[model samples]
Target: MDFVLVHGTTQSPAGWDRVAKLLRAAGHRAIAVDLLTPADLPVEGYAQHARDQYDGERPVVVAHSGTGVLLPAIAEALDARAMTWVAAYIPDFSGGRSLRDEVVELFAPEWIGVDPTADPAKASEFLFHDCDPETEHLALDSLRLFSPAVLAAHRAGPAPEIPSTVIVPTRDRTLKPEWMRQAARDRLGVTALEIDAGHCPHMSRPAEIAGILTGHA
Candidate 1:
């Protein structure tokens, strides 16, 4: 499968550098896409960035963190074959169309601590749990903050139904892990898997995440 992985807010595609290497080593097609949103723009704008890159192919859409909200639309717009989300954000919209109140609720407290002027390294601690101090600092160097408005706007729902895989990181600091798992089942009819990693499983346990994808592949 042609797997195109996406990054979340306050992030670029750099986090997938290591995972892409591992995927290639295992003879799998892995492409980490660049969701080029402004440094200070709301992440929902980044969702549109994701939509613009769609090529309407059967590539596996892999979304990490904030981009999950966008990938559903990407999959529908591009007519993707499947999706495998890694600790991704999935919104359960209440009406015909609208961002859930959960948007601001999900990251509010965490957003409060991050100074709008602070860089990625400082933000990583809040999004991920128990990562190497240096690794966290290094990975977060490319971070950016998203506004609540952008995230809400990016809450585009998926087509009637689609096949998807959602991997919930049990120790995740970003979202309630258990709730995310149940969400995969309720929202997207996802074939759910649980990994014992934090928000960035591709970084913390590349092989294991790859293993699950390959198993599905």
Candidate 2:
């Protein structure tokens, strides 16, 4: 199976390195799309960019953090076999609401309207508290800044119902875990798989993530 991993807004594709390596070791093709470059694109444009990055057969598209806004469109464009959201936003864009609007209230007070990429310490504290020193350092150093335009992007139409799973990070310091569960149930209409980790679980718990991916596939 092919897995296309999309990183969060403040992250680089390298964030998916550990997970990708494990996926490959398990005989699966895993590709992490670079959604940061040309960061001015809208939600739909980012979906197109994600599609162009991988040419594999119908893939299992995975979204991490803010990148979940791109999942539905990317899934449609790529004819994805399944979708996975990792402590990620699940934008409904219903009533023409922007991704930020849908998820803003769920963010921690310190995280709202602040650029996580600007402060490595805060990024590590909020997103990588569960990570080892090596992985935490890599994630902090590779943090990327995104334009406000992308945060304001919204879908114009409803998305098709696809097989999907949400992994909620119970110890996440940025987005509230309680809301994550509620959102998954209310918006995605599914119960989330709770994992004991911070926001960036791929870096902190790659083995477990890889197991879930392979097991579900």
Return the TM-score for each candidate structure.
0.79, 0.93
- Among the numbered candidates, top TM-score falls to 2
Q: Cα RMSD (Å) per model?
A: 3.7, 1.7
Taking all chains together, the TM-score of candidate 2 against the true structure is 0.93
Q: Would you list the clashing residue pairs of candidate 1? A: 10-143, 10-144, 42-147, 44-150, 120-140, 121-140
Worst 10 residues of 2 by lDDT: 147-156
- What is the alpha-carbon lDDT for the whole of candidate 1? 0.67
Residue-wise lDDT of candidate 1 within 63-94, one digit each (tens)? 88766767676565545678777888776643
Question: Which regions of candidate 1 deviate over 4 angstroms?
Answer: 37-56, 93-100, 104-124, 146-148, 158-160
Q: lDDT for model 2, on a 0 to 1 scale? A: 0.83
Residue 80 lDDT (model 2): 92
**lDDT (10s digit) by residue, model 2, range 1-217:** 9999988878888889999999999899999998766347767787888888999888999998877777888888889999999998777645566665655577887777677788777887788889888888887876887554665566546656788889998999988888889878877788999888999899899999999888876
